[model samples]
Target: MDQISLALLSVFFLLVSIVWYSWIFKNWTKKLPPGPRGVPILGYLPFLSHNLHIQLTDLARKYGPIYKLWLGTKLCVVISSPSLIKEVVRDHDAVFANHDPTVAGLVATGGVDIVNSPYGPHWRNLRKVFVREMLSNKNLDDSGPLRRYEVRRAVRNLYGKIGTNVDVGELIFITEVNVVLCLIWGGALEGENRDKIGARFREKVAKFVELLGKPNLSDFFPILAKFDFQGIEKEMKGVLPSVDEILNSVISDRMKIMEDSGGEFSSANRRKDFVQILLDLMKQNDIVIGGTDTTATIVEWVMAELLQSPHAMQKAQQELTQVVGLNNIVEESHITKLHYLDAVIRETFRLHPPLPLLIPKMPSKSCTIGGYTVPEGSRVLLNVWTNYKDPQVWENPTEFKPERFLNDDDNGKWDYIGNNFHYLPFGSGRRVCPGIPLAERMVTYLVATLLHSFDWKVPEGVKLDMEEKFGIVMKKSTPLLAVPYQRLPSLDMYE
Candidate 1:
């Protein structure tokens, strides 16, 4: 009986050894992309940097455009070059259509929401509703007044502090919050109450965003996520309730108003405005954050870059003066006509895309990119930042040059839609950002309003700080502090 038991144990060990070696051998022969091999079990997790985009780009330089790295048990493939990017996002796009949500991501969005949802029938349905109801051109145009009102309010507020310094990012952020929040629900939040809650809500949302980028062991080794080794998931849960509480309160107040008003505010033909509403999808932290953060950050970057490059700033102002004139205020309609301003926007995007890595795409099956096998479920990060700054793609890439976008050689080439692989600020294929129309309009209009309304310059000895703080949303290390004075013809124009 002892000999029989010993024989069974030996057979089990032998089977395990063979399977493990076979798996290793298979991966070795699969033509996987080259990358640094880290310590056993932990893989390259220990070596990652806080500025994930810059760190990945540095690795790409050493390992070529396509490279792989292991973060714990997970495989991360970084795609940097344009040609290789096309392979994954266009050629084999279907295979990489899915998103591999991080442990923190799944918690914040609960495996739901359009941004983090797995690509499938359900996601497709959500996208359909999002595009149709929220982002369609008609919907955007109908809601233009709401956006314009917010911008005008911002302009007025800045006018009050004509000589005083203002935080460009914070002001734009608060304004955007109002636009998205008020547009989605309505006058549910009004007067002084809205102002107090809006400021507090921004802090809560910012806190949630800060947590998402924190290094989480659960993200790298998700199998043990339930153990909450790092407590990131637990912390994320703690954050969500606060965010949900604000959202629910706003929505609940709106619903009560509708009920008390005999559903007058819930009219079927109602425009999405400060007073009109209807939509049960009230857990809109994702929408509000996405809409506000990216747009506001870009505006801040645009202003920072312009401040650094006086020539560009003068040119933009010159064009604005010609297009909008001194007597008039910046209207959304004026945004399209401001050619130099458009180039400035593209330049800023090229230099500093809000989502530097874009939302990471995960493949459904093993696929080949640049002759290397990217195994199924690998976290594929499309390095838009690297592509944007590649000297091969841009002339003097690191230099802040808005004219590169306006060059006639690439006439009609540098568009927001990612058709020309080299310039993809908004990404490409099916999963491209659906909010481009709204985003482009908002950022352009807001920047145009600021530029057209005020001649901005950093205070003496401020050094025009453009240092970036890396996060899910790239923020100015120091929020832009510039003095604004009346550039418009009259104060009534602001009103």
Candidate 2:
């Protein structure tokens, strides 16, 4: 055949194959949820917005509550309706319990930590250690003194900067990280070393979180993951060593102590801090990142909302004053009685959940949700932010109103347990955040201490910025800068 005839035949075969494949795909995915079309190969990746949560929500508005998108070669289904979310997280919890860890996540956690570990026996064991040993009621209760000490220390630090502008997020981040370290290994590191190590750990963790939030092409196209085109995974690996070094030192010291004590570390004689418990099972980086980052982010968001809404702040302060009194400092014991403060926290969570989309869940097997076929290994994102802001479910959903939670109309109506799908700030079902108990205690205690001790306002000529910077953990685009004035009757209380 002539060159032109050969070329024409090749083109004809290519067009024929494309038509055949398109037909097969249309028929195969007939039951799949509808979504926007995308260009070849790249799929909808090129069209994605930086704020994926809001973008997904906007897509939901167009394509209905449950919609699918092809991100490169990956199939992602975002479910925004409460009912559809329940179908995925509740009804088919087991099938969809596995996490689809990104390259950064895998590198940071080493694919063994509870957050990103595949749903299986190993994951179950890790979770058990986390829940029963680290975050059990007994453990948290035991760590109360440490938590209180850290919060008090933070308040004292703030006392020195009274009337000076402070980065609320940074302050809370430092305090929460310290609190978490103390809870994990209170007596292990002390004095200057503790501060130095804590600051370094925070620096590394900040990088880790930022990297985790960054868009990586490797995640969309697994075939390209080996190349590390964005270098996100490489950067994450670099950051992990510093974190691992600190953890290793702590672990080695603890091991030496165990050896010095002649196996008494295993006996009832040894203290049962989180580190002691984790040493029995495995070294965990997830708990450090997950516990500290999420708690601090929530505290920051709550504080930002409070500073912006003076009435809400005053109400929370009033509740704190009434519960703990002006003369005494806020304590964990006072957390339960501060119902209005609880409402404010709930409201804050409603408005700005730290993990807006929650951790991505991957199905271990093919499952059907909302009468649509969810192929095995497909990524499932429950749009908790959209659910929280849905006008159909909430009255004036955009308005920051804590009173909505204060009513006694229904017991346990709004909670983080993931029972109420519409209000799943901590997510739901079997893969629900295992850190709920500890997170609740940390956030409430931190907020109460800060508010009860001082009245905070945005610095002069500064407007409180509620704009969110979307990441693995959603945070304020601008760090909250506020000056705090002493609210307590006695300055001695701060000391």
Candidate maximizing TM-score: 2
Q: Please give each candidate's TM-score.
A: 0.91, 0.93
How close to the true structure is residue 429 of candidate 1, measured as C-alpha lDDT?
90
Model 2: per-residue Cα lDDT over 1-495, one tens digit each:
999999987885566456535643864845888999887666788898978889998898899988889877678889888888888887888999899898888878778888888888998988887788788898788778888888888888899999999998888888888877776675666667777777777788889899987888898877568889788887988898898887777678777777888856655424556767768657788778888888878899999888878999988888887888988888888888989899999999999999899999899988888888888878888889998888888899999999989889855898789889899988888888898998898898889889989988889999778899899899889888989998877879989
Per-residue lDDT tens digits for candidate 1, residues 66-104, read 998877667788889989999988898889888777788
Which ten-residue region of model 1 has the weakest summed lDDT? 273-282
Give the candidate number with the greatest lDDT. Answer: 2
Model 1 residue pairs with clashes: 187-274
Candidate 1 RMSD to the real structure: 5.1
Q: Where is the poorest 10-residue window by lDDT in model 2?
A: 263-272
Spell out the clash pairs found in candidate 2.
none
